[model samples]
Target: MKRISRREVLKTTSHFFVGAIAGAGLNSVLQGCADTSSDQSAIDDIMKKTEMADIKNIKLTVLYDNVLYKKEMATYWGFSCAVQGLDKNILFDTGMYENTLMSNMLKLGIDPSKIDELVISHDHPDHVGGAMMFLENSSDINVSLVKSFGSSFKKEVKERGLNLREIDQPCLITKNSFSTGEMKNFTKNEHALVIRTNKGSIIITGCAHPGVVEIVEQTKKITNEDVLLVMGGFHIMNDLGTKTKKIVHRLKDLGVNFIAPSHCTGGEAIEIFSKAYGPKFINSGVGRIITANDFI
Candidate 1:
């Protein structure tokens, strides 16, 4: 494939937004048709289901994290991962630095122009800082963020003519894949990912401010499947070892099969989880690449 330069992407950006608006108009018309008849709704449902691929065929790559899994990749105080081998190449969160994110992508052979969609867990700088710069001239314009994001951030996205998807409830992001929605609680309102697999369900979070265990339990309700693996930052950097141990026990009690905690999960928490889950603890960090083969 021909690599599209940043200049070329900017030149074509206007056309892309126009096409998106036209497509939205088309979808609105179709939505009315499907709403008026049960058969149309059923057919739409089948089409959506057909787009889904089995989890065993999926690959998850940690593109950006505070820890380094590959010696050549740089690490920053943020999180970003790529979910590929599905209907769309989903880019989850953008790390703290633009150069680091792009350079790492180049090293990993991830073409920016090929990303089909972007999912932002929350509005934190670590999670969204690089994205702001990455989106400045990129071809990928579709972004899904929680509804609670600040007006300035939303305005910036709209001003750039990007397709802003403000999700307030748990919804199907792709076939057989879901967003745990905006986890409304004590911490920053966040959204975690839930992908239903043949084996069970996989949950991916950015910071998991509401609690990783809570997010996993939420996935059970969202996808109606047993928890398979949970990855990403747990945001328990300040938790005491005793507290972390109890949290680990609770996660096991909830039937969590595997874990790959990193970033803000803290050393104490990571150690507790590592000891508890044993071999099931998959090390997570920048440059960590996980595929269906790791689980199934």
Candidate 2:
């Protein structure tokens, strides 16, 4: 992990439950996602581990995605990212297949054992399928997911002695990291990751089911900072020609400095983004590694 004195971060357990925003309206969008006492305990343990570690540069490596940047590794219709330089190493999502996800991670020189926790984006096969394999074989590390997940899946995770953090609201993940809780709207249940950097915030989505533009807007509003970058699946594969023109422009309008659209972001949408972002566009795919320093 990398270290440097940070500007401001939560240092006590009391601050952990309040969430990225105390009451960011949500306008009842996340309706029916209630919480339990045990669920609260799970999240507490996951966030309290390394409050001492300072953040410097956050290294985000796309370990698994639909696009292939390095032909040496296998690509699948899924998404996963390796988050480094924080207090604990985090695997953002598990991808579609366990073997393929693991193979690509090793090919990229990432050690599975070094991951301290796993933050699954949603219940989709492409996102959570590979997780079962890792969770069954691993121990000690925490698995953070939405509280609305099926009981059988949660049962299996607890059976392995792996800590489970049932996320319901935006909360701290580690020192500078946070989960947008779980947003549900057009698609299904999903969440984005937020890493507070010195410049601004880096917001990562699994399949912006709740709307990519909305996610960026809410994060910027909650964090009180402009978004430096927005990466991961935009899930805009089905839009017609030029339909995404406004979305890309809206992102740029939202003060997003860099854009990395991968996974389900579709080729047409990617092209439009490239034209919109110009030099700031990143060809994000499997094996692509980006750091906060690269943009800063």
Candidate 3:
């Protein structure tokens, strides 16, 4: 796997838009929709249609990440997961690069065209990197994202003719699944997904810029259910000494039964969480799968 710096990633992403506009003859259409801002009022009007009914089992497959679990899976600096056994198949985040995302999906036997819902945690390239590529393959699904994303990004979704649901408050994606809404930290805005199972709720995050503990607490507030598993990037890689440890303890205190950190979660933090959670810690890397029965 090749290592890519954030600067290089952003540069390449900019070039992608340029190439897409010219090659797809979308310059005029893109420009025409550029000023069309997302209608927050309309998005707010959309309500949850179906609820998950006491699902005893749910499966989450890590499709893309910075860590590799299978020998053949490509590792990259991003996160994407497939949530199954819900009312609909949900895709959480689209990894950093187009080829890597598509290749990993292919290897995992996942067809992007079959995904019913796309939930973007934030606007970062690592999380939304494969948006255009995946959208090209499938526009038959609804896209749920934070309102804080760039206007141009929202415009692109609208222009592509996909249903866009802009969220700012905690809401049910389906009856048994929920979003933590848009949580603001000093630097970024993010939302974490919560899936209800007979055992407990599974909270899935992307980078967790707003703080993993904070997101977990918000999920608890919404569902009033204990979190059986807390997975995905915790974003505390640079936390020097006791900071990450404190966060780990806090999560344990909050009744998180399992911890499976990956991507931006540093190695040292994972070790701390592993020790703290003991057998409850599951290795979360690209190609890793966690089923609800594992928790029960």
Give me the candidate number with maximum TM-score.
3
Local distance difference test, per candidate?
A: 0.73, 0.74, 0.76
* Candidate 1 runs further than 4 Å off: 1-52
Which lDDT value does model 1 have at 99? 78
| Better structure of 1 and 3 per TM-score | 3
Candidate 1's residue-wise lDDT over 74-152, tens digit each?
8889999988887778889987766799988888888877787788888677787667554566543577888886665
Q: Tell me each candidate's TM-score.
A: 0.81, 0.80, 0.84
Q: Tens digit of lDDT per residue, candidate 2, span 55-123?
A: 255788998999888778799998999998887889998887778898988888888988987888877
lDDT of 3 by residue, 1-296 (tens): 12234354366442323212222323222111112233332223222232444545577899999987787899999999998878788999988887888898899988887788889898888889877665666646777888777676666566566677777776557656767777887666988888877677788999999999999888776666778889999998887749888898889899999889998998888888888888899988999988755664
| Candidate whose lDDT is highest | 3
The regions of model 3 sitting more than 4 angstroms off are 1-56
RMSD of 1: 7.2
